[model samples]
Target: MKLHELPDELHDLVHYSLKGGSEDFPEMRQFLGVTVRGDANLIWNKYKKLAKHEDKTAWREWVAQRKDSTAARREADEKRELLETRRRQIEERLLEAGWEAADLKFKPWSDGIQQWHELVEMPKQPRPLTDRVWKNLYAKLKPLLETNREERIEREYIKRKIRRRDWLEGVLYKLKRTEPPPLLKVKPRQSNSETLSSVFRSVTKRDVFPFVHDALKLPLIQQMNEDDIGIEEFREGIKEHQSKVEDFITDWQDKTRVYLVNLIQEEDREYSEILQPPKNMDLDAFARLSDDQKLLLRADSLFYVDTACFRTLMVDQPYDYGTALQTAYPSLPEYQPYDLGTEPVYEPEAPDLTVIHRYATAQEVARDLLEDLGKPNASFVEVNQLHYSCQRCHDKSARDWTSMLEHYINHKQIQAKVDKHASLLAEEGIVYRNVHDRSFSNDRPMIKPARRSSALGARVPVKMCKLCERKPIDLNVTLSIPRLEKHLLEVHNVNDPKPEVHYSLTLASMFGPSPGSDYEIEEPDEDNEEVEADNAPEEVPVEYYWPESSELEDEGEEEWAESDLQ
Candidate 1:
C-alpha cells in the first residue's frame, strides 16, 4: 500500500520504524535492493517508547551533560596548543640572543618559570662596556628593539649605578646650571648730558673727523657817507648800511646759538653713561623731550630764545626779558629767569553751534523724530511715526498730525492684525519679535509668498505641511533621539526594533496602533497630561490560551515519529 493510504496510527508506526533503522532497515533495504542490518520496525518501536513512555527528562539531561564535557575537552586542547606556540616563540628569541640549549636552565615556581644561562656567571666588580664595544652592540641590536628600548636601557643603567644618590644629584645640578636665567625686571631710563659727553669722547677717540685749516673769515665793515647825497639818497644809504650790519649780527648769533645747543645736547650721553641707570632711555623720549628741555633751560637762564633770528611767524614770542637775552647768547647760563609754576594750562576749544542749527532743518528734524520712533524709511508711516517726528516743527506741527494719523491707522486695524499674526508666527519660530523696541513689533511676517521672477520663467508652489496645514515655520526640532524614540513608542504604540532587538517597526507605527488608522490611539499617562495629547484607542476584545500536558505529549510524539522517518 502507498504511505498516505495507511491508517494514521499504522502510518506513524511505519514512518518511525523506517526512520529508526534507516541505515540498516531490512524491509526498506530489500525494497530499494540495498544492504540492510536490522529490523526497521523494532528500532522505531524503541524511539516511540523513549518519546512517550520512557524517562525523557533524564535522557535529555544526560545528552546535555555529555555535550558540555566534549566542549570543555576541545577548549582545553586549543589552550594547550596556544601555550605551546608561545613557548616556542620565547625559546626562539632566547636562542637568537646566543643562549645555547645546554647553557640555558629553567626553574619553575608557583607563579611562573624563570630562564637563566648556566654558563654565564655573575661578575663581582662588573666594568661598563667600552664606547667602541657599546657602539658595535647598539648598531647590531638597535634594529631589533623598539624605540622605548633605549629609555629602558638608560633606566637600567641608572638603577645599576654604584653611587646612585651622588650621580643623580650631579645630573640635577648640571641641568639647573644649563637652564637660562629669567628675563631682567628693569625698565629703561632717560639719557643725560654726562652720557652724551662720554659717547662723544669715545667717538672722538676713534678719530671720526679731521679739519685741514682753523682760521676765521672776516668781512669789512663800512659806514655810508650821507652828507654829500640827496635827501632820498641819504635816507636810502643809511637804511642799506643799517640792514647789512643787522643781518650780519643776526646770522652770527643764530649760528653760535645752534652750535651751543648741539653741544649741550651731546653732553646728555656723557651724563647718562656716568649715572649708570637701571634701564636705557626710550628712543621716543629722547627725540621728543631731550633737545627741547635742554634748549628751554638754556634760553631761560640767559633770558632769551635760542635761534631768535631763525624764528618764523609760527614761533611763540619771548615770555620775558630772560627769554630775549637767552636767544642772543646761549652760553651765559648764570643769568637765570624767575620761576613760573609748573601747572599746565589747557585752552578749551569753542563748541560748534552749526550742529544745533542743522538739527533744526526740516529734513533733519523729520529724520531725528523718525529715528526716535524706531523707523529709518520716511515713506513708511507705521515705522516712521513709531520712531520719528515732523520734519518742520517738533512739538506743535507733528503732535496733532501724528495723533490723527495713528488714530486712523489703528481704526483700520491692520497694525493690530499684523501684530497678532506676527506673535503667532513667533510661537512657530517663523518670526522673531524685537524685544528692545515696543512699537516695531516682530520683524518677520507669517506668510511670505514666493515672488515671481521673469529670469526663472515659472514659479513653483510653496511647500506646506498637511496635518497642521501650514508650511513648517522652523522644521528643526531639538529633541534628543532617545526622547523621540520614547515618544514614538509610548504615544503611537509602535515597536521600533533596535539593532540589538531583532524586530521591525517604524516611527509612525510606534506613535499609533495601525498605519494611518485614527481608530487605535494611545492615551497619555497621568504624569504627561500637561504635554501634547495622545488620543486613546477604541476598545476591542483579545484572547489568550494555555495547552494541557497530555495534548503536548501527543503532539511531541507525532513530531518525533515524522522526524524519525525523515
Candidate 2:
C-alpha cells in the first residue's frame, strides 16, 4: 500500500525505520535512491552485515567477538545475582531474629577481590548485647582516678552508668560527692553613741530649772494655809451660809404678815359693817373661802368673816329673792352666751325692677290667651279691631274687657275641635265641606283615599300552563319545574328524567322529592333492552405463541422456495 494509505501501526513502523537509517542499507539506499550521511555510520554498522552477504572469515571474527561480549555480560549478571541473593539472606536472618532490614549494616567492597573477600567475611549484622553483657562491657571499659578522688571517681562512674542503665544511681552518687557551701559568720552589734551624747548635752544645759512652785502664787493656796482646811472645812462653810439665808427669809415673811393685818383694819373702818373682819379664823378656814373672798381678806382683811356668821348676818326682812340670790351666790362671771343670730340677720335682696317687660299688647294678649285655651285657629285681626273700637268709648278697662270677651269666645271646646280637624285636613290635603244647620255652619272634612299594601302575596299566577295542560295553576309554578330541569340538562348536562306534576296539589310538593331515590327507579322498556343487546360487543382472551424449529426453517426457506417456484 502507499505510505499515506498504510494502517496506523504499520505507518508508524515505516516512519521509524526510515528516520533510524534503514535507508542507509546498501540494498535499501540503492533501491530507494537515498544518500547516507556520515553520522548514519552507527546505524549502518548495526544493520550493514545483517543486510549484506559476508565471507566465512568475517563470520568467524564476528562470532568470536560475540562470544567474548556474551561472557562479559554473563559475569555481570552473575555478580548482580549474587548481590541480590546476599541481600535476601540478610533480610531473612533479620526477620527470623525479630529485627528489621534497617538493622543490618552491609559495607560495600571498595578494593579489589581481596576487599570483596574481606567484606563477605565481615558479619552482616552485629548481635544485640544483653543487659549483663553491657554491664560487663561497662565494667571493663570504666576509668580509675586518684586526685580529687571523689569527683573524679563520680565522673567515671557516671560515664559507665550512662553506657549501662543506672542513670538515677549515677546522678545521686555525683550529688553525694559535691561539697556544701561554707557557713556565714555573724558580727557583733554596735552601741548608739550619737543618741547617748545628745541626752548628756541636754542634761548639762545651764538655763534648765531644777524645780517649779505654781501653787505659791494662787489664792486657793493662801486660803488653805490660813485655815489648814480640807474638803470637810469647805463643806462646813457652805452649810453656815445656807442657815443665815433661811433665818433672814423667815423674818421678812413675819413682817409682811403684820403689815398686811394693820392695813386691812384701817380699810375695814372706811367700808363700815360690810367689811368687818372675821373672828377666830384659821389657815384652813381661810383657804376654804372662794378665791374672791381670799383676795379681799389678804388685801383688806376687814372683808373676811366666819362661814357660819356670814350666813346668819344675811337674816333680816325677807329679801328680794332674785336680788338676794344674785348678791349671795356668785354670778356665772356674766359670760355672754355665744350669739349665732337668726341667719346672721342677712338683708333680703330686692327684685330687679329695671328689667324691661316683654309684655304683649291687649289684643296680642287676648290672642295668646285664646291660643292657650287651645283655639290657635282664631282670627287675630278681628280680635284686635273689637278691642280698639271698645277702647274708643271707654278707658283701658273697656279695651281689656273686650279683649277678655274675645279670648273667652274663642276658648270653647267645640272651636278647639274644629281647629284640630282643620289642621289634620291641611296635612292630608283633603278638602273640607261646610255642614250648615239653622244657627251655625261647621267644617266637615272629607275622607282620604286608602294607601296600597306592601305585603308580598303568593307567586301563583291566574293562568294555566299551555304545554302540560296543568290548570287552575300559577304560570310561575309551571316555569319553575321546566326551568330547573332545563338548567340542569343544559348547564350541568344532568340526564335525570322530568318530575311528574299533580295539578290539584301545591307546587312545593312537585319539586320536594330528592334525586337519589332508588324507589323512584325508571324502568326500561322492552324495545330499549332489545336495542342494547343488539349493540353489545364480543370478548376475546389473550394467548402466547412460540415458533418451533420446523416453523423457523420453513420461514427461512420460504424466500428460497418462492424464488425456485417462480
- lDDT per residue as tens, model 2, 356-467: 1211122233333333333332222111112111111111121222334332232232234445656653554333221111112123211111111223333422211231
TM-score of each: 0.14, 0.14
Clashes of each: 44, 1
lDDT of candidate 1 over 16-101, digit per residue (tens): 21222342454452233221224334533554565574668864554455456645654565445445554455446547776454
lDDT of each: 0.28, 0.28
Minimal lDDT window, size 10, model 2:
203-212
Residue 277 alpha-carbon offset, candidate 1, angstroms:
7.5
Q: Mark the regions of model 2 whose C-alpha exceeds 4 Å error after superposition.
A: 1-44, 50-56, 99-103, 106-566
